[model samples]
Target: MIPLTLGEVARVTGGQVHPGSPGTEDLRVTGPVVTDSREAGPGALYVARRGEVADGHDFVDAAARRGALAALTNRVVEGLPCVVVPEDPDRLSARPDRPPYDAVTRAFAALGREVVDRCAAAGGLRVVGITGSSGKTSTKDLLAQVLPALGPTLAPEASYNSEVGVPLTVCRLTEDTAYLVAEMGASGAGHIAHLTAIAPPQVAVVLNVGSAHLGEFGSRAAIMEAKSELVQGLVPDGLAVLNGDDEALVETMGGRARDVGARVVLVGLGERADLRATEVVTDERGRATFTLTAPGLGAPEPGLRVALQLVGVHHVGNALAVAAVAHEWGMPWEQIAASLAAATPRSRWRMEVTEREDGVTVVNDAYNANPESMRAALQSLAAMRRAEGRTLAVVGGMLELGADSDAEHAGVGALAARLGVDHLLTVGEVARPAATAYQQGGGARVSSVADRHEARALLEEELRAGDVVLLKSSRDSGLRVLGDELAGVTD
Candidate 1:
């Protein structure tokens, strides 16, 4: 973070500095801003937030013990220097379903906005905001890897796309930082808009809109409206990169960009795209190799060929988005291609592949799942099946699907059967619909397990040397942790 004195932080956040010692208001914060006490270090300002389970105020002493300079809290801490931001009066009556955006969180968000404004005014900082139903993290990871070749780039640590997460990411900016990749996520209207206000992007990339959060937004059209907020937040000279293959997005987002007077670039595998991919092919390992063409952007030669190290053909769209951003920034096509080709999966549990000593391959894509990504992972799993090996898919229930939950799960099972998967193991009562569908579809051995324990036991008994297995589900289903255990990953 750009160094800020306690007094400066208090003024920016509309708080008052309560000194633990004399002259504390003049002390400078030069380290990372964190919410978790364990991550606190010298010069760190720990944000004391009230969560559903615990209050961050209780951890002020823990943070101070770990070298934190002060705390940003709703109330004063006895021993720790604090920037006291008052709690919102309406917080006590907030709806049970809404996200908790209390006073301290809002104040922390203000501090993040202040830091970003200061950094941009100092020059050379270009903020890029990315939003979509799926692929946000994958694309953010890819851009974080590729953009640094141009200059210093800072992206969120993991899937930090929420209100607090966006601020946490923005506050990390230093004076020399050249790029900020803000991955924006939304469960309802105005979530993206609020995040965009914190770090307004010069470039906004809206990936495809799907059924990832259909329950929350009620419909795909509503989801599109929420995702379009990023483009709507752009300034007149800003750019909007959209997925051309998704006609719905192209129509809606293109209009939004025009309304905001921002320039637009469409990226996809289709011919209508300004930046499109050709000669796309995936190797036996399910990695994609494609030729990227952007005739509209003034290419030097025939076009660049990009080979991705990340698994799955779905990543081809993500790669094109990255290439478009780099090209807009005037990065050499050769450098962009090389950087993309050299990049690997930095984030965990999304199409993360592991090979056992006995030749069995495990595809751990259980980070989070919706119908779109679940289908994509299954397709890659089928593609990566060894010539003589059986393909196995251990799937858990996809949560937050609302009324369509059963049908969605059934569709996944039917897809597995049609893809010629040799075995289907569905875990939990919520996933029983999938097992029923898979059995009815035939041509495969299907089993239903009550939990991950039974599923693991079944796999341990049935998995063979040449078999390839895939684990997929939403984050709350616990399938990601089970995948880690199955793959012998210890942390």
Candidate 2:
């Protein structure tokens, strides 16, 4: 925060100072802006909203006692300095099911936009926005590590890419903050656009267009349109880094990127890409080693060899995208390569590998899932298995896939069979299609369980000492918990 006064907050959020408020116009918020009252501290502003479980307005006094400077709320607290945003009675009547505290959320977004604009105008902050179907979190984690080497950087802790999550991330920016890496995700059009309005970006990275939200958007074309919004919302003179290997992105999004008037840099394994990888190979642990080439630079050398600490060979493209962004910002090729090689998975349950003392290896990639990412994980698992070693895949349902859900699930099973996984353990009723497909496809061994408990029981009985187990599924499937349990990891 850059020290905005209560009066300024009221003005920016279309709010009014309440008569019961404790402070005058000059009382300012100098600490971080937080939605949870428990995060409030000296000079902090607590934003209160009515949620499904509880109303945040009830915590105003607690926040004040905890050293909060004031409350930004839909209604005022008697002893608290508050900025109250008026509710729309028309909206309330039109949509009776809408939460009454939505007015406060709208105001909070506006406040975040104001603060980001203020910081950018002061020449102290640059916002980098990234969007994609599957790799948003992974690539954001990659950039988070590299960007911090340039300056103080802030990014979302996990998959905090929703509307509220975007504003919450923006509110974390400070006066001396140099970089804000925002991971933008969308299930439909206009979601990323709205997030961009809150914290506009100077550099935008669109990783890929995939089937992650096919149910919501209806088709790959629709998903492409949604993901392209990130680049379309870029500031004037901004740069767009795109995945050239994705046909949907290259064909459909190239014109959109041009229309947005942003300089575009294509990144992938394609020979025509501005930033591309070649001579790619994955080692025994499924880590990738590639020759990264950024052509047309004035320097004598245009290629750099990179061996990523990340597990999947698919991450070569991700590293290329990160290198393009860092390159645009003037980071040397050697620095970018070194930073990428030094980076590992910071977010849990996405290719998190653990080798127990008993010689059993566990791979947890259950953060979320889709057809593309499921196939990628299966391929990586196949690469890690030795001729004498057994491989078991504990998979769950991939949700939000709409009408093609069953077919997609079956395809994942077929891929696992093609990759020669020794055992295919499909967890939950929704994922039974995978087991059926694998059995019908002549896959050697398969099992289906109704829940995590049954899956864990069967695995405990079947798993061998030297076997490698891969746990993969959508987040709601609870496969990550089972993976951690099998690995004896507490947190």
TM-scores of the candidates are: 0.96, 0.94
Segments in model 1 whose C-alpha atoms lie over 4 Å from true places: 20-22, 91-100
Name the regions of candidate 2 deviating beyond 4 angstroms. Answer: 20-22, 89-101, 298-302
| Clash pairs, model 1 backbone | none
How well is each residue in 84-178 modelled by candidate 1, as lDDT tens digits?
99877785454623445788988988999999999888876898999987899999999999999889999998999988899999998988888
Could you say which candidate leads in lDDT? Answer: 1
lDDT per model vs. reference: 0.90, 0.85
lDDT of 2 by residue, 1-491 (tens): 77899999999999988763365767889887888889889999999987789989999998998899889988768767899998876644433223232688778879989979887877658888998878888998999999888888888878889777888888877777888999898866667887888888889998888899899889988888778888888988899888888766876777777788888888989877888898999987889998888766432255788899899888888888888888888888789889999998898998999988877789999999999999999999988886566999999999999999999999988888888888999999889899988888888899999999999999888877778889999999999999999989996
Predicted structure with the largest TM-score when compared to the true one:
1
Q: Candidate 1 vs. truth: CA RMSD?
A: 1.9
Model 2, TM vs. native: 0.94
Local error of candidate 2 at 203, Å? 1.1
The C-alpha RMSD in Å for every predicted model, in order, reads: 1.9, 2.7
